[model samples]
Target: MAETFERLPEAAETGGWLVRDEEAVAAQRGVVWELIKQVGQNLTQGVSLTSVTLPITISEPRSYLEMVADGWCYAPIYLKQAAVEADPVERMKNVITFAIAGLSNTCVVKKPFNPIVGETMEGLFADGTQIFCEQVSHHPPVTNWQVLGPGEMFHFYGSGELCASFRANSVKGHQEGIHCIDFALDGGTIIYGLPEVWVRGVMWGDRIIEYDGLMTFHDPKNKIIAEVKINPEVGGWFSWKKKLPTDYIGGDIFKYTSDPSKDRSSVSKISGSWMGCVLFDDKRYWSIKDDCPKFELIPADDPLPSDSRYREDVSYLKAGDMEPATEWKAKLEDLQRAEAKIRKNYCQEKGINYVPV
Candidate 1:
């Protein structure tokens, strides 16, 4: 008797829509498959079984479409899995377990286990048996996966709750300085009758190298399933030092000038005639017009110069010095009399009274 088998919809006609561009869809599928294969190979080579768990859960079925002249159809299905572990030694194992589980689940839903692809059909096995399986039928299709951001370069993806929280914090520009990782699993077909599984993990070291616009994920049905608009909030750490001039001055000297010729020599000179008259009058010409000698000669009998009265005036102008008696006595008396007369006049004019305190 011949063995029975179920036939899957061709990769180009898995979905109802007719694929117009078959070559493009095939190319995309090929890229996706290559990435999935690389990831699987890395997991198998890097992970050890003693310290890690297996058969981790994955979320979201990967799907793509083949465009036809009239419509489109779903293609072969792709799947993804992710996991996290603090210990470096067990992290690879965790990732591998999830990847294997994802592959096995895809096969169980789409086709029977083919021993030719290294899939086994053992009813029951004793403990400590290590089974290795390979599948030639597994082909992953690729799609564009873009990262959007204005925050730290890294991210992580896990369970729905955790992803929601991380996304919220990242949008707010409050995500801590940790790496982010994102896995995009996409293919050309949708498997029927399988419950959508929940996927969650700790992703590290993900960054946005270039962002054209918003981030989006589409299923094979051409429906927009997930979208995150790009509104990059600003955040970072920075420092600066105070800048000061190398030299500083305390006060302006121009305000204290007393003589224009001597004081203003430091400034540029301005020369011009005012009202149509020349300003440069020679000393010789002025003396001749005034009928006076050009220079005066002092007489020998001149009295010794005495400034006793002006001495007190000079002292008062000096801001903080005692006035001489002979110079300041008369001035003080006159000031007192003036004050008395002003007070009497003010009292009489106002017709008001006040006792001296």
Candidate 2:
């Protein structure tokens, strides 16, 4: 542990966050290689960056709570709508629109903080809504969350899986999950998931994240489906600085009467930006920007001993205390790594199988 922390000065020194072109590539790769050797054990396959090779300085230490919480920031937007508006069809439209508002946060490439397994987060809304999230697995990592709203509003339970790959210049992630939200009022639920994620131009300067792939939503009861696909525009050689269409996050959406495979009729086309407005049937539907709320950050003083939010290092990081943050972070990661080995052994001894689901 001491030896790994000793490399921090070098990692920070080699972290060329400001350089460009080959020079930047050289510096970024330099740090990456050192991290691979110093902090990473099995560079291939499942490994949690929260306690591994991720650089202390650049890594976003937000947590699974913050990442998934982005979707609920605008809770009232849909929750309020779901409360009233008795018409079943109208309610269904609002539900889909509500889900769309949640995904609106996915239009950009800010890396979320990784979560340690067993971490949990919960929040309450004035409207009597309760939101909770938990990091359930570390290998083939999975995060689960639920939202229960007031006055016969809705019940939502979702789980997300993050699978990633490495390349010379960047990292890519594929999000796989068929999470759903149930509104018994309409006897419907919307099931959906995200697309492939790319940390583009990682070797150029500060890494940029771009999400490209197909995002789909389906409602088994309502027999309706929605699709959102993000595709990158072409770029030429020496296009390091050239922006791609994916960067813009402009994509078309199609709402079908049912699953496209089974029923492709009654399709309504929507073309627009995921971060902004989209043209739908000659009208425009806007995306969420600041209309959401930040997750209630658990205060250090109020956290239970077991809460990840209260970990000394995380507290210091949030408070802008760099020295303690670094020290505690290193110790915490070390502790987690050791605990993982013990858990693995215990599982084997007890003949218990930890399932991803």
Q: Write down the RMSD of all candidates, one decimal each.
A: 50.2, 10.0
TM-scores across all candidates? 0.14, 0.71
Could you tell me which 10 consecutive residues in candidate 2 have the lowest summed lDDT?
A: 1-10
Candidate 1, lDDT over the whole model: 0.20
For residues 26-57, could you state the per-residue lDDT of candidate 1 as single tens digits?
44344434533755544323232122211111
lDDT of 2 by residue, 1-357 (tens): 000111111111322112224544555566667776765635433343433445445434566565665656555666457546565434444554554445545433334556667777666665567777778877667888887877647787888887776655567677678767677565566677766666546544455445566667676665656665554343321123444334232222333464555556534543444433333443443343334443433333354445556667667777888788888767866776687888778888999984432
- Candidate 1, residue 246: how far the Cα is off, in Å: 80
- Residue pairs clashing in model 2 are none
Error of 2 at 242 (Å): 16
